[model samples]
Target: MRGEELQELTLEELQHLERTLDVGLSRVIERKEQQIMERLNGLEQKGMQLLETNKKLREKVEELAEKQAVTDHPENVFNEDAHSSESGSLDCDDTSDTSLKLG
Candidate 1:
């Protein structure tokens, strides 16, 4: 039918047309919402994976720092002469002269 002819419908017919349009629009909105939720779920999964990878890298960095501290010690680089006042030299200050008897 022509546009003018369809516009000239009675109020009851117009109400029926409005109800049909509402049903179709509601379905379209529902599908759009479902698609957005699926994309959000995928992003959350990727974020979790990134967090796990960051944690592993942090652990590796800590391990390397410990190894470097042992290999390149401060005493070796400074080249300060160490004098022994107590027997069985331990990593302690002169205030505490007690030696630990380690087997």
Candidate 2:
């Protein structure tokens, strides 16, 4: 209200106006609190989802590591027939020619 209008109001009217404003301010504060609580709940749910995703990713990494370990082991790579070749000797099949042909 303008200064002239506010000056026209009696003491009782000013007290009533104060009470109305207090009620409006309380409602506004309550709505803001509710909004904050909702946002907090959303953030908590997102955090849980991220944790679950991280767990799944970790498990996948471990599984891949185990598979890689089996494939990358020296014994597994060179010993498919379960026999160790003699040192300095070439293990070859008799049916196959060992010489390289030049064209």
Candidate 3:
């Protein structure tokens, strides 16, 4: 209000204006608090989502490592049949004209 308008108001009117301002300020503060709380809740949910994603990624990495370990082992690269053939364990008959060559 202008200075001239303030001079025209009685003491009771000024007190009423003060009370109205206080109520309005209280409502404004309450709304701001509510907004802040909502933002915090949203951030918490995002944090949980990120944590879950991180856990899943770690699990996937572990699974891949296990698979790699099995494939990388020399013993697992060849089966029993292949091992026996590679070791020249086959028997040859003397009557046969064919001869076996070992590398």
Candidate 1, pairs of clashing residues: none
Alpha-carbon lDDT of model 1: 0.77
Best by TM-score: 2
The sequence of per-residue lDDT tens digits that candidate 2 reaches over residues 1-103 is 2235687789999999888888988999999999999999999999999999999999999999988978865433446455455565556668855665566
Using all chains and alpha carbons, the TM-scores for the candidates as numbered come to 0.59, 0.65, 0.62
TM-score, model 3 to reference: 0.62
Clashing pairs in 2: none
- Model 3 lDDT tens row, 1-103: 2235777789999999888888988999999999999999999999999999999999999999888978865433445554566657644448855655556
| lDDT for residue 23 in candidate 3, whole number 0-100 | 95
Report every candidate's CA lDDT: 0.77, 0.80, 0.79
Better of 1 and 3 by TM-score: 3
Comparing candidate 1 with candidate 2, which one achieves the higher lDDT? 2
Error of 3 at 78 (Å): 11
- Superposed model 2: Cα runs more than 4 Å off: 1-5, 74-103
Q: What does candidate 1's lDDT look like per residue over 1-103, in tens digits?
A: 1235676689999888778888988999999999999999999999999999999999999999987977865543322356445545545457844655556
Output the better candidate (1/2) by TM-score.
2
| Model 1 ranges off by over 4 Å | 1-6, 74-103
